[model samples]
Target chain A: MEPRPTAVRPPIHLRIADDIRMQIERGELPPGAAIPTLAEISERWSCGMNSARGAVALLRAQGLITSGRGKAPVVRIPPRRVIRSSERHQIEKDLALKPEAERGAIGEAETNLNMSIGAQRFSSQYDQVEAGPELAKVFGVEPTTLMLRRQWEATDPNTELRLSWSVSHIPLDIVKSNPALLDPNNEPWPGGTQHQLSTVGVEIMKMVDEVTARMPTTVEAQLWGLPEGVPLIFCRRISIDGDGRVIETSDADYPADRTELHFVTPLRPWPKRRQA
Target chain B: MEPRPTAVRPPIHLRIADDIRMQIERGELPPGAAIPTLAEISERWSCGMNSARGAVALLRAQGLITSGRGKAPVVRIPPRRVIRSSERHQIEKDLALKPEAERGAIGEAETNLNMSIGAQRFSSQYDQVEAGPELAKVFGVEPTTLMLRRQWEATDPNTELRLSWSVSHIPLDIVKSNPALLDPNNEPWPGGTQHQLSTVGVEIMKMVDEVTARMPTTVEAQLWGLPEGVPLIFCRRISIDGDGRVIETSDADYPADRTELHFVTPLRPWPKRRQA
Candidate 1:
């Protein structure tokens, strides 16, 4: 279909922004290089200073450039993010019987190395609640049954804004066997969820992560210290045991700019073909 | 770590905004319900009108509420998005051999149900370029060899903003056997990419989608009409043929609020134990 006439006339600022963006992508203006000032762009592009400023603003919003009050805009060099692959599930399962020192030395949690927890305010809330229809289906239990919900959050000490957050749900009946599981102080469970489940006779044989993305609420944005145009990655991980029972469901969110989720699928070798 | 007090306490508006946000999450105010007016909020919360207005503005920017002139802000209900599963690769392969009429009836484009192609401006550009070092490694071809790069975008009819964007790359030599493959007009090709490649004796045996999320820059926010704190989902899909040769690479971007990606992994049945 032909485009609507209203969409045909690209705005002046957008056209200007696209030109500068192309130059950056083509490496004519390299990362960390200062872009032309509004006055310079106005003179070169025969546009008003406001239009030039708008172009710069547009570029900054797209994360192509960075600028502060009274500072010239410059191309941004994004930091490298570590990839946390789902394949780690298999590795964690194999490490269940290993000593704590050996497990700690693996350095899996420290691998990506984005934010440091030491500089944040951490909180954990533990509560028992009836499972909703969604959780009940996953847990293979009645909706009225009580489930344990643990919420964890870390706020930036300086801004008092949220840095990270996650919530995990487990059947109350299973984890109640160990009273420590209900204690908020017992968090950061040394070996992570795998070890926590092992204490409850749950051997997780498989895990599936469903991933999506969405705009954060106003309160969420402030907590995450997110910039404009950035989205949050939402993942729901379902863990199943050897008996095929769903053991737990954990939901986590990551800021898109600083998080990369990787999934590695190792294929089984095809059976050898019979000789003709 | 404890949160440090701010030198200038955040304005009352921010505190009020946070409180209202909590109310929404607690189910006091449900999605799609009208938010209280500035006057009402100011009176109820014992805050100034400016603070109330600021809180509403913050909610709108965060995508929690939607409003316009003369319209009171209402809680936003995110639209339901279609989940595109990777397991469809095998299904698509089987459908490729069907008659063109049957294939056209099945329509692969239906996957994007919430995004209407007719409501936006569409653009597609095709170019022949030498494979860069990274792409050359995947294609197992010389860097000097030509590759076809295709970029597509849909812009909103009213705002002239980006709605959907993607780019695909294929070795020119592999697809050039069919001249039509070079034409952008043939997009939404019956049976999708697999069928298009089949014309050249290329059968995609496997496909992998690498997914990540990040915040968008200022310009991207405007283009996608993303609210503050929204993240974008980035996915790179790699297609490999029976010979284990990478045939095509396609990258797609989806607005976080309206995209869900599903992946299914089928496990092989365990081999029978050897007779004792």
Candidate 2:
């Protein structure tokens, strides 16, 4: 199909930005390589200094390059992405029954993080609070019902940057009998929440993860040490018991630049009647 | 646990912004309601006009409110999110076996879009291209291998705004036998790619979705008419055949403000020996 002509061409700044973007995608401008200076860009594109500056600003907003005071713009060095897979849910369940000696050798943190466990600072806080309206609706409980809230955080020991953080909530009535379940010191549990639930004779048969993304608040950005244009991925995982009751919900955030969530799904065979 | 006292308090602008955010979250300031004017905010917070302006800017950067050149800022009205669940892979496979009349009633676009099918304009473009280095590596094929690329888009007819878009690729050697598979006119093909591949004796048994996010470029923002601070969610779906070969790959983008991806995993029960 022939292309339709437009009334006006794209602005000079956009053309320059697009050209630079193509170079980056082609690997001609690799990561950590400084971009062309403003003078060079203006001469090459035959545009003014303002156009060259606009082009640089456009690239920064798209997260393709980084610019700071007294520094040349460089292709952004993308962070190493850690893959978080849904397959771990079943693995954790199976490990819950393993011998303590073998299970103790492997913690979920060690499996998920690239750094040594000793280099990270971990904290857990547990409290009993009334179920708020949002959580109460999910749990199908009264608004004033007691719920156990657990907050966990792992930070880099030297830089104090947040490595991982999450909050988990469970109905207090379900796990009250298991005193170990309410203790924060019991964290780094061998098999994670699945094993904790098993102690109460509750088994999680299904896990649902709902994923979304948003710009982080000012405080959150400060805590995560996020870059200027990055967003945060928000994931809420809900566990369901065998009898179809919602047992627990955990909410976590991952910096969008350095995390990838992988989900594997197996499909049923197509019916023979429609086989061509 | 009590929070320890800090050496210094947060800036006045942050306090003002936090208070307004609390009001929005508490429903005291509903969506689309005009935020306090600069004069009003200054008086209420006992701060200068610049501080009040800074507070509003903070809210805009966090995507909590909207501010334009001359208009007062208002609480952002969130778009309605459409949930796309991983379960649809099986649902599509099941639909492939149904009769044409029943299958025509549902399309992939209808399942993912918020608008009626009749109100949207759908287009599909088919082309033959060489598998590039990145794609060739994924397919474990030679770089010169011919691949069929299909671009699909659904747009609002009246506004020409993009509703949904995706690009899919399959090795041409695998599907060249069925001429119908290479034609764009054959789209709206009942049951989508799953059914089309079924005709070629290729059954997709497993699907892997890799999810990440980043800021959109200028062209994308213009096409989607997105607000100032929204990000784009990137998802790559890889389909594996019965032989465990990656057969098809599709790349999709969704506006972070109005899309939720849901994945459901059913875990296998522990061995009988471990069942307590």
In terms of TM-score, the best-performing candidate is 2
Q: Each candidate: how many clashes?
A: 20, 0
The DockQ leader among the candidates is 2
lDDT of 2 by residue, A1-276 (tens): 335345558899988998999999899999999999999999999999999999998897677998666799899999889999999888888878877776778888886766778889999999999998999998899999999999999999776779999999999999999999998888777767887888898888999999999888777877888876788999999999888899999999999989999999988766566533
Residue A113's lDDT within candidate 2 is 69
lDDT of 1 by residue, B1-276 (tens): 555555756778887777778878777889888888899989987988888988887676555777555877777777677676665667677667767877776755455545565565778899999998888887899998899999988776677778678889999989998999999888767777777887897767677677887656546766787765466789888888777888888888877777777665433322243111
Candidate 2: Cα lDDT at A116: 78
DockQ (Cα-based) per candidate?
0.26, 0.63
What is the interface RMSD, in angstroms, for predicted model 2? 1.9
